[model samples]
Target: MNKAIKVLAGLLVAQLLVILALQTNKPGTTQVAAQPLISVNLNTVDTLRIDDSDGGQVTLRKEGDRWQITNYGNQPADQNKVAELLQKLSDIEVRWPVASSAAAAERFEVAEGSAQKTLTFQTGDRVIDSLFMGTSPSYRRIHVRANGSDDIYQVELAQHDIPANPESWMDKTVLEFEGDILSVNAGDIAVSRDTNGDETSWKLAGSATDSTDPTLINTWVKRFNSLVVSALVPAQEVEPIIVQNPALTAHLSSDKGDADYAFYTANEKYYVKRFGSSALYEIASYQAKPIVEIEAKKFMLNTSDAEPPQ
Candidate 1:
């Protein structure tokens, strides 16, 4: 009985020792926190480059507080979208590495040259940081590897969140105007609104014999109130489009200022250029139809059809 008791006590001690050893060296129980995958300060970042495996690329540069899509004719970038991307880069914390071996990297698509997407951040000419992202282990979780490290981690960023298309970063509403519209002139179609009145009244350029349809005029004028373009045409590509006689030309005066717009069509695609803007804006056919196809006769009231002005 005494020998059996000692043997049982020895076995219990060995089991306790093994448990303590495992508790000390557990995989993720270290006191030190996991280092961040991306550690560059966003304020110092002035340029961003995104490249995808499919040969698509986009570049954005910071000028003052505004961001511009440098590859897309220096067009203004969507500030909110840029801010969100920067915030995501700064916020991603690496809890644990899903992989670190070279073979593992190749299997996960995060190997040095095998990554699906590469994001590079730069300050002036120096690259501040870069990351290679590939393969979604799950929804919103992307396998990422930092520039100088072999350890690849699955982070909470989606692959589509960083688009390689320049248009995805451009501000589509850059041409949208604000303030009260004062007057509009388009060849024979001219209209002006009363600026100093509680109720706004519009006067057409033609005589009473050529009275205008208020609804049609109002509808045509409102298109400018909140114009949104579908895509941006680079300045180099727009020269031929602009040099030719435009299909339609219109000038507008607002409380804020005055501006002119020229519309054109090439290969069945519609385009518009604001007189002072550096680039041409591509608009949808539906958006251009009502404005470009407008005729003075269409807006003029058919008084002959009226019942003798009863």
Candidate 2:
């Protein structure tokens, strides 16, 4: 009887040890993935629309493989800027949740109707996601709520707001005149230069030019070629503001018969309307005066006798 009891006790002890070993071998636990605030494949994106609180809106469309600023006269969008914007949106991960109450929305600038800015992401006219940008919690982070969710999340992005102005996305290279100019008509005055790419020699139509410094003509052409503008507004937006009687009109004809450039003066300000664009441009009076005041004699050196810049 004693031997049988000992055998049964040993069997029970062995069973318990096996169970403990089995539990120790299966000790791995499940882990949950960190959810991203905004997760959309970039290649699938179609359009990005931005609406501002000040009643301004901009639409950018992804066509083929490139993006275009659709609303601003279908202007070519700045690809580098557009890519940066897309990467920021894609990398947004929820750092933490903020206030979700209705009153908290307005105070935080994430309210459904009163948000400072709203970004609408679409895939072929179908709204995929809408993000309402709110007040910044810090310079490096912002409060944003996506898809009408009551919960406002703090994202890692530092952007205060999405770009709403079409010009903001437009490539600043509006016009790059690279052709060899053959002739120029500055208002009532007309001027012609050597067509063989030598701007040093210039002649006025029906008038004998005084002994003028050849370099002066060359320098003016260089200035005109390198002329940069502070800002350009689409003609459709502020057409009424454009002056009908321009202070100066300069028509440039390149070998390729390229576009013309016109200048206007109004309200003590100078504006330029480049060829091809319906937009009217505003240039500083100080900058525009030098180019607009160009004449046959202006090319003459100020010395007692006109001589080339030595």
- Estimate TM-scores for all models: 0.81, 0.67
- Candidate 1 residue pairs in clash (backbone atoms < 3 Å): none
Tell me the tens digit of each residue's lDDT in model 1 across 1-310.
9999999999999999999999989988777577767888888999999999898899999999999998888889999999999998888888778778888888888776678999999998899888998899899988999888888898899988999999899898887756678788986788887887322266677645347656666667888876778898866788887778888898999889988888899879899888876679899888877788776666667754322111
Backbone clashes for every candidate come to 0, 1
CA shift of 221, model 1, Å = 1.9
The TM-score that candidate 1 achieves is 0.81
lDDT of 2 by residue, 244-285 (tens): 766776777777775678787767777787766677766766
Please report the candidate that would top TM-score against the real structure. Answer: 1
Worst 10 residues of 1 by lDDT: 301-310
Clashing pairs in 2: 235-279
lDDT comparing candidate 2 with the true structure: 0.72
